[model samples]
Target: MVYPEQQLSERQRYYNAKEIAQYYRSRPWVVIWRALTIVWLFARFVLGLKLDEWFNRAELNKFKRAGQLRQILTDLGPTFIKVGQALSTRPDLVRKDFLEELIKLQDQLPPFDNALAFSIIEEELGRTVATMYRQISPDPIAAASLGQVYHAFLTTGEEVAVKVQRPNLLVSIKLDLYLMRWAAGWLSPWLPLNLGHDLTLIVDEFGTKLFEEIDYINEGRNAEKFAKNFRDDPTVKVPLIYWQYTSTRVITLEWIHGLKLTDTERIRAAGLETDAVIKTGVISGLRQLLEHGFFHADPHPGNLFALADGRMAYIDFGMMDQLAQPTKEAIASAVVHLINRDYVELAAIFVELGFLTPDTDIMPIVPAIESVLGEAIGESVGEFNFRTITDKFSELMYDYPFRVPAKFALIIRSLVTQEGLALTLNPNFKIVEVSYPYVARRLLTGESPEMRRRLIDVLFKNGKLRWDRLENMIAIARSDQQFDLLPTAQLGLQYLLSEEGKFLRRQLLLALTEDDRLHTQELQRLWDLVKDDLEPKRLFDVALSSLRVVSTEGIAAILPTANTINSL
Candidate 1:
């Protein structure tokens, strides 16, 4: 259980401390201003008080608050921008204004001089710009807070996009991280909410990723890994990396010319099917999560494209996550439990997934899940909204001893962004309907014996099979891929022939299905075999006498259904 410490070079450690010290020295006012802002916001929103002198009247309005926050983050620079981007995904923590505006928060800034970008590329790659590309665009095709991209063609006639990191990105990011750590420490004592634990973890995770992202070589590796994962998938396209031209500061990738996924009108104008595009996106997302264990953490519209030939292309790979298989299976199980309205199983799943700490009592979590699932289970299949259910469930987590895992947050963000874009393209798009195929396929074909047993538990009641659950599984399986139900049916038939199975089946059908009568002529044949056996009849009578709960309608349903049991 021992963990190894990370090894950092002396220079790196020095710079880390230096940046922290410089942050406070140069920008104490920034920290103070934000601290005051937090206090004012908590008092105004949480406590319902108006501080007329500290804030503008117009900015205090709920509708204007998101814009105000976005402007504040943008003005604060790269570190806060990253913080805002991370906060955008946490609907449980932030208000609607903050969530909406932060989702639209762009990191775009005016491009640095083309000459400086060219010089850096040449310097990083150890070659002149002329030798790297036959022709390279002087103007940047796109510019963001950290880097700028230019279109270029290699001498071999390969068109590519050259991304050059900003000159002082590392230094600026370092200083910003320092400022963030300082601010977090400064605000820790007086914060109204018990967010200190979650806040510290978030900043730590962000810093870990921030350093990883600044290394262009790591980004190249991420793209290559994604490409390897989807090498055979024609629907998903990952940009090819030119490793020979890539370095810590500059990366060269195959240029893709396509419309952004958000541009629904243009995608339609180009004769692309919106439904197919969304389906492909969802399928690819599932494969990354369930099959490969690696996923594109950032799937916003800006990083996705709809190609001319109707394929989906993903660009930025700086943000990616590796989900462990156990977590993935738990998620699949949770989905099935939710669909079946099994609140107890779903509550245990939350504990199993590490959202709840081990040894913590689950009794308290069960009611919250039940309240949400009760409202949800009544809805028809098409009425299911994944985001709405997820948001509601998240709202419940705010008061519980639940920790939001980083990968879980990224998964939510990716789906929310994709779902929003899909709805924009087609108003009637339902995420669960499209995603159900994946979950269903996994449950039926999954390798876990325990999971398979759970499936049987859902299908069986008091050792009697409920044919409807069987039929639903068959239907869901048939919708996506071919399934051979003969084995499952044979297993059920084996149980039907056993002595205990008869009583269980009789009790289950009578108690569960009210009006759905079953034909049970086959039961007469089985009884005819036992009629001659006086000893077995006596045993049955004894067992029947021990029953304390019995319903007349249940017995009536069983009689008719038992007579009608002529087929599997």
Candidate 2:
């Protein structure tokens, strides 16, 4: 449902901390650190603390600390619950125990007063509940941090879920958000995260996303986009939004009666094959990430259901991801190179995709990849082990200078998350085997053409042929570039072209030792005398010497031009 006309009231949507204090009843510090406090409890889970019978009473209290959080969010209502939903999917952000508890929040909240619910329905839809549904469930079928769902049938005869926003939810959210924002301001001088990257940015991001979730209009449009992306694929289901019955605070959708993908008992009882279910879900997730580029980011167990017909249903598009065209191609290409066992290419793609700096040295990360990957590149993904991949790579990227791309963070979460669900279903699903063929085909048959070309251009222009890159390097050098590329890459390449150029100096020294023939290993080996950072240019001299050679390794010596990559 598109509600271009339904705008939130000024007072409901906007308020300062002073204005908000009355409703939420906490100082800014209490409300904001509540987030940090929840994060600390989440840390216990990530650190693998035994919160069950093995944990000490005080240590076991971590469970209560986390549980108390779930209770508080329920008390806070819609905005916080929505916040919880977003937090649940962020593996790159929250720790595992927190993910477990946050996910446990699927349908656990005190229902809003039925009388008040009806009154709000009347006020929102401008119609009575009886007119909308023949019979509305007094008890909500499910409740969460956000809103509760009531099973109903339209008077015209359709089973639907009526999601109602908590009464006075806007007032509470605005006040809590104001307090959180102010607390961040007050705490900035004292906290490491507050100054550069910390709780403040997190709260602000959480607050913004929380408000976005409250906007039924945003979810409506996100759902519409998903339905359109999969219009041709019926195996995956997203409930059709009934716009006429929708408003800023209320959303109505076709009711789906199926076991959530994580519910093993209900699924097994319904006589479905768990392995096939796992395959379809993972494959479809791949399609969403690679083919369509727009996907439901929060496809946690609660949001995915296994239908009677053996199809997986994806719902709850409150948090979704959209990759830019260039980003999509870069990721797709990276996948292909990874499958083909081209570590250098994979490293290069990282730079192309803006995942790392253009001048960043990837040689350091290569051994880590080899250490993690070894010779197991083509094995069936069903048999691939996720623990080995994650454990070895946990600090891999962190070893190099990098920041997680917002999109990649969510996408990685999606894959690792489905792996968790896969453990429940098949317990042996290796995602890589599935991912390999998809990537292999892309590399063999030109999967992401633009990205491939961009990568090739980058590798050739700057990587193998240092002398040829003089033009590109010259532009950066001549322009007074600001990035780290200037002092290192541009300067290094600048020296390679001049009489003082490292490559020329090295080559002249080597060729002076022996009459150098162009484009041979002996020539490159001799040139290596200069230095490895300057080693890439030696290969370029080979390419320029007009040797009729076409080795793939030889061609790979080049690096891509990046001044124009940002446009993508």
Query: What CA RMSD would you report for each candidate?
Result: 11.5, 13.3
lDDT for each residue of candidate 2 in 143-166, tens digit (9 for 90 to 100):
655677889888988888888877
Candidate 2 local distance difference test against the native: 0.61
Candidate 1 global TM-score:
0.72
lDDT of 1 at 425: 66
How would you encode candidate 1's per-residue C-alpha lDDT over 375-413 as one tens digit per residue?
A: 765576556667677667766655666666645767777
Each candidate: what lDDT? 0.68, 0.61
Please give the distance, in angstroms, between residue 433's alpha carbon in candidate 2 and its true position after superposition: 2.6
> After superposition, which runs of candidate 1 have C-alpha atoms over 4 Å from their true positions?
1-72, 83-108, 179-196, 376-378, 447-467, 481-568
